[model samples]
Target chain A: MSSRRDILDLLGENARYTTEDLAHMTDFTESEVEEVVAELEDAGVITGYQAVINWDALETDAERVRATVELNVALDRETNYGDIADRIAKFPEVTSLRLVSGDYDFDLTVEGDSMREVSHFISDKVAPIPEITQTVTHYIMESYKEQGTEFDDHDDDDRLSVSP
Target chain B: MTLEPADRVDAVPPSGIRRFFELAEEMDDIISLGVGEPDFSAPWAAREAAITSLERGQTSYTANKGKRELRTRISRFEDAARDLRYDPDEEILVTAGASEGLDLAFRALLNSGDKLAVAQPCYVSYVPGATFAGVDVVDVPTRAEDEFKLTREVLEASGAAEADALVYCYPNNPTGATMTGDELREVAAFCREHDLVVFSDEIYADLTYEHEHISIATLPGMRERTVVFNGFSKAFAMTGFRLGYAMGPEEAITAMNRVHQYTMLSAPTTAQHAAIEALDNCQADVREMTAQYDRRRNYVLSRFEDMGLSCFPASGAFYAFPECPWDDADEFAEAFLQEQKVAVVPGSAFGAGGDGHLRISYATGLDELKTAMNRLESFIS
Candidate 1:
């Protein structure tokens, strides 16, 4: 049972770790590991697996732009902010959405092909939402770190040549 | 004029482990299980502390014994964990990793021709370090049948009673054998009866998986005679930081510090600060890493069973010592590396009892370990 939590933790760090790899790491049989992972996926414990990429390192010209858009919405007498949040979450570009306290009713992370597209999405789609009273978008300039992994600088193995 | 090295230095063989590393370096696409250090980097907090210290211009050499804050922290840590109390000011001496601590203990305590009894299939450093100190080493061979525990009978048979001191490492390097407190009591009694000083190397203390690691020093009448050498290398993955400490009777620590004062001067000032931070705040990180090592250790043990290799389950450390079908471990290791491209250290690299066994480290990523195991399966078959 504890292996379930352990698997999630390991996969959370690097989802690329195969079921076989996870089995070896967690001391579970390959089939057992497969069963638990499938159960996790079925139960919504594992929502998705992602590749944490340093986009700046890519040589391609077409780069994806990301921004965090905070929204302040009026709690509807009939349906609360959940109705508007549900509408905003349906956008394909909205990568993450969370109902948060302190000023913003919803915190969202949105991604698009370019900064102009992100701006267009906010001005065209987000602005038209009657329930949302205020919307603020902060375009991320650069990511020094993402998903708890550092990308700006590399950690070198500084250990001695022969340390026994 | 000829540049001649000392006869004593020439007598000791160069590290057998280094040869395999060199072979792996020259080869292409070798999956090496030969590394002894942890694959993980130092926890960010510890590294940040060192960086912060350096940024604050705290680069001057610390006192010969090391910073009082680190010593005090180590003292408190030992007291809480091992039930061994040490005076931060006088009973602790930080050195350049546990390697230096081992060296300092040998140099400070042993006179020329003094016999230092060391367990075989142990860390490679014990014999060479003793030889460098001009001390004679009596090999006490522990068997896989005994789970690699240094027995009273084995010690007596090896004539350890004639030795001045005993150098013991539990959750031992290469073997990964650990002794329970109850099991260690007999050895402790023997050490007491024989009036032998004990240099207990507990560097792998934090890596024990089966049971809690016990310090022989915590045994009755053992603290005064035992010098406990522990460090951040194996536990906190702070090998590069070069930090370790020795705790013993004030006199022994003073003696070690005397040599330390003349030689190493002091451990790295930045590392000492980092160690203080590690002891104070990194228990969770250590626990998490230890769990990972445990899983890997068990996985390797299971793999060894599936391969039909006789392996004693390692209770501590990150190595799995499995007896090979071949008689000559060195030849097997060489051939395996050359043919299969999977690198493992031969047991003979450690000492006499290490023959016919290969020490496979599981410190690498699980995927790499699985690949190595697959290749090993193919090679052995």
Candidate 2:
């Protein structure tokens, strides 16, 4: 019961943590941990678990190019930005989409193998949407950091093996 | 000419922990639960602040007392955290580290032949620090039965009631013992009756798990007589920065600064800038790091319980002192390292009341801790 949050926080940080590990880390027995996790998964609170990968460190052939597309859409009593947002969101390249307030109406991330591929997806798929008024795309060049993890920080435990 | 150590060498022995370090160096695949420091790096913003300071050519020595902004920030932080206020201008003297602050306290507060009663099974440096200051020390061993807390009864038994001053830390190192409010008041009353000036080293203040940290300096009449030592080393994961400070009566701080001026000149300029950022914006970072330590603490304790090994309910610090289930802790630690490849500190290194126990620091990664626990279980069984 107390471990529901502890499980969520632990699993959120590292998906590799197992039930036995979570049981030890939290105030739950192994069976109790399994029960709580199952309830969370059943309720869709435990949506999915995936690794936070440093994609840029991989082989160039496996590299991905991503961009944030600021989407301006025309809306009337008949059609809204949500309608067009749903249409653009169907493409697998559209990884994250949010209808935010401010300079942009619908901001989204589109990923592809190369900048040209991202540009092509925008022109072919995103531009075909009738209600979207304008699409501005900025290709991400390199990521120095992501999800609070540094891509280039090589911090070793250089401290003494034992200290007072 | 033969290079000889200073005259004080005969009085102070090399660190007891140093002997165990040699065997560990030659071992392969050792998972150390032995390190006494936090595993996390200093918060990134604080690191960036230092870089920005360096880039702006803020490289000169700071004021002997320290950067006023950092002191003011420290004053506000203490006021908010513990409701204890000090005049930042006269009461605070920044030093190179909490280690330096302790050394400064010994020099500024006491004279030769003055008595300093130290709570034992303590940090390795405290006794030696007092000895180097030329103060005769009386070791008051707080017991495992008392959760290693410094009770008035313990003081009465040790003849520390006659000492001029008492030196201790809550969320104590090695034992992880802390005094509750009522418990602290009892000790505070003792200090008052005994006419003992207090040097409360609260370096691990921000790391306690069971309750919000309570400082003995907060007790009535204690503000004027107590010197509170703290820093960013453990809490902010900023050990390498070597920035800490002492807050106390203006006279004591001024005297400490008198010595600090000639010896240290000032703490590193960029590190002071980094400390300002830490105090100004890193409260959440400290809480986050402490939460992580709490989780590790729970996990390690649970593992110890499963193995039927008894550990005092350590509510503070990143360590848990589990009584050795085997014959001798020093032998157990060496054998555990040799057989299981897991490194832990023999409690005897910390002084009296530490023998027959092992200090397991849970500041390592959780996965690594799990592996170490598994190895430890197998080796013991």
Candidate 3:
């Protein structure tokens, strides 16, 4: 009946569960699991299967720094916040962008290889855009949590392997 | 110059599950499905309440029959969940887990030479507990056909009529079987006919999936003779708290409380505080955990079926009792552990009619359960 909901719930917990595993776990057969997944995709409910990684744990030289920029802009008679938001959202460095209320017109999160690169992006690229009255950028120092996951903490299932 | 233990203690054999638990400890990277408790941790609200109580120096022992506040809450909780009522002060006696409650029930209701009929394949503690309570045990085998439920036919065939009391567990451990309301009515009539005092263990009452648990004690003419034992361990993920309560007639509860006061005194005050919070605010958590177990239960059942092993349709608790492909469950379980690094309890450990099967628990994460099932399928192949 609610096979779609069952599959979605299992995948939502761990997106890496394969179709074969889903079949064994669910009442749906292997082919049925695939069909359900395809149906969900077609309906645009499932956009992608993502791996949530802790970027700070990597030991690469190109360490990324993230910043949240609040953009306060003026809307002209012809140009509105939607047009300006679209222009800023197209930047490769922009990871998240939203039209926010209160003092800021658009709130955005940007990631770059270094602080200098991110600062240069806001100064050169963002400031040049017309209708941009003010900008405030705050670089994240440390992440305690993100995306419903606690940072720097690895989950260990401490239950004994077997009991009776 | 030699010391000898009590004869009765020496007479009873040690548990069969202990051997597997020890062997599993020595092995490396063994994925186990033998767990008898929930994998989830205790609710945060309960833990927070316990901490607050402890910080306030609430370290003294509670009343011999447990705290009045907790008992009132338990009484109300039972009334709401099962429509069963207890007079909080005289009809409810909280103990240290259902284990102690079983022991107290045996001593309270049965004499030293009296017989205690127990349903098999039952929990590991019942037989030994009966022995420790100085009562004779009669085993009544409940088959998969009966949904592991005790019935008139099985009871009559077992010589339980001669026994003074009976111990029954629903949403049974190892089997994960439950009794429907109609089925329970039939058993109640049987008990009434034989004048049997029943020790109803409903520890997994809140863990039942897809159906509301109907206590046998709720049926007419059954409450006076039944002592329903339930606890915080299974449903609330509070196994370590070691708190349980027995609800029954005033006479039996007073008798149980007398023994409890002289021997164990009372359940821990900290655990009682946690339990109070758990009963008050953790309904949603209990429902969520039950729903999670239900999904994993279906997944494990399908895996066993695909492997050509027939499993009882377990609609309650978190276990799947499936027939072992091989005749000897012990040999099959050992080889499964050795070859695939996966551990499952041999069904024979649970007693009569439990042979030629395996008890697989589904109270685990979906990822780990998937891995264990994959390993099991490969081993069987």
User: TM-score winner among the candidates?
Assistant: 2
Q: Write the per-residue lDDT of candidate 3 for residues A40-82, one digit (tens) a residue.
A: 9999989888877678878887778999999988888999878
Which one is best on DockQ?
A: 2
Output the lDDT of residue B83, model 3: 93
The full ranking of all candidates by DockQ, starting with the best, is 2, 3, 1
Reproduced native contacts, each prediction: 0.21, 0.73, 0.62
| Predicted candidate 3 versus true structure: per-residue lDDT over B1-381, tens digit per residue | 458878889978988988888888899878778888888889889999999999999999999999999999999999999898999989999999998999998987788999999998888989988888889999988887776778888989999888888898888888989989998998888889989999999999987875799999989999989999999999999988999999999999999988999998989999999999999999899988887888788788887877777887888889889888888999999888888888899988997778887999988888778889888888777
What are the Cα lDDT values of the candidates? 0.88, 0.89, 0.88
Single-chain TM-score of chain A, each candidate: 0.93, 0.90, 0.82
Put down candidate 1 lDDT per residue, A1-164, tens digits, no spaces: 24798888889878988776677566688899899999999999998888989888899998889999988887757877778878988999999999998988889999999999999999899978888889999999989989888896666544332235
Pitting candidate 1 against candidate 2, the one with the higher DockQ is 2
What's the CA error at residue B170 for candidate 1, in Å?
0.9
Indicate whether candidate 1 or candidate 3 has the larger TM-score: 1
Residue B34, model 1, lDDT: 85
**Pairs of residues at least 3 apart in sequence or in different chains that clash in candidate 1:** none
Which is the winner by DockQ between candidate 2 and candidate 3?
A: 2
Interface CA RMSD, all predictions: 3.0, 0.9, 2.0
- lDDT of model 3 at position A60: 84
- The per-candidate count of clashes, in order, stands at 0, 0, 0
